[model samples]
Target: MNALTLASASVKSRPLHATLCVLAAGAGIALLCAIFLLSGAVERSFIRNAQGIDVVVGAKGSPLQLVLSTVYAADVPNGNIEADQAKRIEHDPRVAKAIPLALGDNHNGYRIVGTTPDYLSLYDASFAQGKVFEKPFDAVAGALTHLKTGDSFLGAHGLAADSDDIHHYHAYTITGVLKPTGTVLDRLILTQVESVQQLHAHPDLGDPDAAEDLKISHEVTALLLKMKSPLSIMSMPRQLNKTSNMLAANPGYEMARFSRSMGFGKEVLTALGAGFVALSALMLLSALASSLAARRYDLGVLRVLGASPFTLSCTVIAEGMMLSLAGAVFGILAGHGMAYLVAVNIDSLQGLVLPQSFLHFGALDGALLGMGAVTGLVAGLVPAVSAARTDIAGILARGRA
Candidate 1:
């Protein structure tokens, strides 16, 4: 029989063992694929959130927290910086623009940001419908805001408030809708920074601020500053810290810091993945060795029937190659299926209005699949060697005994 035919018969002879090997190898491969997808997705999410802003200046707290709160709209602010301070920082020769954020209230879980029209341009926010918040209390809704024109968002109060509550308590009009930015900005309720300050300023329970000038509030949540040139950023934060109560952090700095922490975890997980692949290889070798010990007489019969040592080696190696192919293919499908499941579930959970054209796939996924195939092929080597060294006479005598 040809090497291919012999290999096929050998696999059929030990179907259970072959199937088990494929399963074991596939499990390791699936894990590798999952690691690649999840870690990559997280990194992508971070990048998406911090796309254009060069530096963030906020109240003295964690830089990452400031980014999360103001940029991503993830959490409430710890404190607010003065509006004049934000404007002074904006006037720096190195500073291109500063988009001040005044945050205090929430429309449901989403934050309400009071900032200038510059924020709309800075974040590239557009109108999905209607326009930006033009008049005070004439607030524009985020893509995620539960409120519409006639509909009012349940502010701090759970139900629609009466005129007394609407005027004094935490309530806002849903005048316009922001286009999806695909970032945390998409989830905010945006209005003039003065409007946000007023939400907190009025002494009476029902009276929000009647003041039109924003300088009166004297507080803002954060400032997003873009540098004229990135090189100009080196001493700018030091200069600003000397004059103001705010702290400045480069987005690139935090991105690298986070990447190192993430990379350390990835390295540990990768090593563990490699260890599992090694164990699978050893199991495959033991199985092949055991099968060879039992089949020595069969090998001798094949040799007597004119099968050359080279053909015997090819037959055994071909069986291993077949198993590797099967295992790798199954692993790839399982991995892809898992990635799809995560993407689907995340979409549902966040209710993020992602555009159809936003999906990004790259060479990294392909490289991971290739690594899985290599792992499987490496696992199959021991059995291939055992089959090549079968001794006919010795096996025949041992079988006879």
Candidate 2:
């Protein structure tokens, strides 16, 4: 029989050993694959949401926190900037557009964002049902939020999903349901800035005079700014930080720093994956070497039956490749499966909707497969050489003895 048939027979003979090799290799590949999938999805989501805004002007605090809290809605705000002062920045010559965000409440787990209709235009958001909020206490629910048009819900006082401090004085009526944009907007409840102001100001609306006084001292969580030009982007943040109480942060710069900080953990996981892969290669080598020793007599008989030395060597190499490739395929599936689970179940990764496909093949996947195949080939080479150089007469004599 041919080298391929011989290779198949040899692998079939050692089911347990083959399975061990496959599992070992698969573990390594799965880790690497999952890392790539999850990291890419997170990076894309962050970058996409961070777009349109050149600078985020918020109350003085951690710039990264400001970006995360304002842009991604993943954290609590730094503090609030005076609404009048933020409005002055809106009229700045360098500012093309400024959308004010008033935060500090939630319904269920979704954040309630108070902003103008221009906020919808910034994200190119479209309505799936009804229309945008035009009056105080009118709300527009995100596609993923539980509320639908005409529905009403009282806002919880805090950002936490389980906050019991509900604003019973006023309930927000859902005027619209936004189409899913796969961005932060999908998880936000949008309403007019006045709605948020009224909710917090008139917690006890029975005191109308007290509520009016509170209205005069309005504050916004942040200002999402689009600059007039490239020069404005570079100059505006420095100007704002120096001249005003608000801190202006570049989303791109903050995200880059965030990515760098995250790189350390990624490197650790990658190193572990590499170690497992190397161990798998060594295990494969040991298994092949042992198999070669046990099959020397059979190989000798094959040589006598007109199989060339080249064919015998090829058989051993082919067997190694088959086992490794099986592992690679299984690893890829397992890795993406893990990533999918993380995307759906993890609240932190809720902003991103990862590819739900079972086998999402990409350039990195091909590289992984190639790495596995190469590992197998390298592991098999020594045993293949030993098989090719086998002394047929000596092997037959030993077998007869």
Candidate that scores best on lDDT: 2
- Top candidate when judged by TM-score against the true structure: 2
User: On residues 1-401, what C-alpha lDDT tens digit does candidate 1 reach at each position?
Assistant: 68778768878888899898777666666666656666666566567666667888888878767766676665555567877777778887788877888776666556667887887776578887777778766677777665565445534411121322332444567778887665566667778877766655653433443442233367887888778886867678766667667777777677778689779999887777667666766766676667666666777788888888777777766666666556656655666566656655673223232432123445654665566556545654665566667767777677733
lDDT of 1 at 354: 43
Model 1, backbone clash pairs (residues 3+ apart or across chains), number: 4
TM-score per prediction, in order, is 0.78, 0.92
lDDT of all the models against the reference? 0.66, 0.86
Clashing pairs in 2: none
Model 2 off-target regions past 4 Å? 121-128, 205-217, 355-359
Model 2 CA lDDT for position 394: 88
Per-residue lDDT, model 2, residue 317, is 94
Q: Estimate, for each residue in 1-401, the C-alpha lDDT of model 2 and write its tens digit.
A: 67778898888888998899889878898888888888877888888888898999999999999999999998899989889898899999889999999998899979989999998887788999999999998999887786789998998876988987777778999999998776788899999888888777766545434554365339889999999999999899988889877899999999999999998998999999888888888898999999899898888998999888899889999988888888888888888898888877887776555345324678878888998898889888999999999999988877843
